[model samples]
Target chain A: MARVVVDVMPKPEILDPQGQAVARALPRLGFSGVGEVRQGRHFELDVDDTVDDETLAKIAEGFLANPVIEQWTIRRVDA
Target chain B: MARVVVDVMPKPEILDPQGQAVARALPRLGFSGVGEVRQGRHFELDVDDTVDDETLAKIAEGFLANPVIEQWTIRRVDA
Candidate 1:
């Protein structure tokens, strides 16, 4: 089996309230120096060795990420 | 400034319904050969150069992840 990692992040133009909440709470929690936080989604897929990169990309784009508001990257990782 | 990436994943024993939903939908969507899908959270932090690894680790563990149910890994990445 091959392992594929897909990272989906909100588009740069989008507002991420969850990330902003973290950035705001950091200073109050005694952790400083973090300027901005952007939260996103990560997916790990266990696929058969026969599954090719194109198929993985299709799965990532068509299923794992929403193209309208989010962007995604796909890469094969060591199993 | 430096970029820090924090990946938070549910503990292996925890049920991931979101991931399961995707796994179940993939085959229905005409994609096959994918055995399992695990979904998690990804965070990108813009931090001052002064923020040390120890502090970043604390931020990831104390805030970004629920120690009781999730596990996290922290790494510095090229900006």
Candidate 2:
């Protein structure tokens, strides 16, 4: 089996309220020096040996991320 | 400014319904060969030069992840 990692993040121009909330709460929680906090999604997939990188990319783009608002990267990782 | 990436994932033993739902949907969506899908959170933070790796680790552990159920890794990435 191969392990694939897909990280999906909001596009730079997109608004991320969840991230904003975290950024705003940091100082109140005694954590400082943080400026912008962008929250995103991470996925790890265990795939059969038949799965390839191109298929992983397809899965990331078509199923995991909304291309209009979020961008994603897919890479094979060590298990 | 420095860019920090914090990845928070559920402990291996924890149930991940979100991941399971995605896993179940993939085959129906014409994607196959995927076995286990684990979903997690990804965060990118723009931090001042004053913040160090240790501090970033503290922020990830204390604020970003629930220690009892999640594990997180903090790393510095080039902007």
Candidate 3:
């Protein structure tokens, strides 16, 4: 099987309330000397090796991600 | 600066409808020899090296992820 990964982070220009909220909360929670936590999501996938490149590319573009809000990269995890 | 990564996958027990739909769509999109596309996200960050481990750990758990629905890992994106 080939492994796939995708990540989605907030647009840089967009207000990242979650990241800001976390930044504000961290100090209160006893985490010192840390600031500006930008938050995002990550994914891991196991795909059958028989899957070819074109289809996986389609999957990444059409279904796996919303391009307006996020950017993604795909790679086969080497054995 | 240290780079942080987090990945979250749908629980295996839960149905991945997005994956199933992508699996179905790929063939229609003219990609052959493909099946079962599981999708997820990836993240890249440039974190200050002076930030200690404990704080980053807390960021991973408290802010970067929603542990109930996702699982995550963190590593320094080595220079």
**CA lDDT scores, all candidates in order:** 0.93, 0.93, 0.64
Off by over 4 Å in 2: none
Query: For model 2 chain B, where is the 10-residue window of minimal lDDT?
Result: B52-61
Pairs in steric clash, model 3: A6-B41, A6-B42, A7-B41, A7-B42, A42-B8, A42-B41, A43-B41
Report the lDDT tens digits of candidate 3 across residue range A1-79.
7776655577777677766776677678876655455666554555678766665666667766677885666676752
Interface RMSD, all candidates in order, equals 0.6, 0.9, 3.6
Candidate 2 local lDDT, A1-79, one digit each (tens): 9898899999999999999999999999888899999999999999999987788888888889999999998888898
DockQ scores of all models, one per candidate: 0.93, 0.85, 0.41
Docking class of 3: acceptable
Candidate 3 chain B, poorest ten consecutive residues by summed lDDT: B35-44
- Higher-ranked by TM-score: 1 or 2: 1
Q: What is the interface RMSD of candidate 2, in Å?
A: 0.9
- On a 0 to 1 DockQ scale, where is model 2? 0.85
- Which should have the higher DockQ, number 1 or number 2? 1
TM-score of every prediction relative to native: 0.98, 0.95, 0.68
After the best TM-score superposition of candidate 2, give how far the Cα of residue A35 lies from its true spot, in angstroms. Answer: 1.0
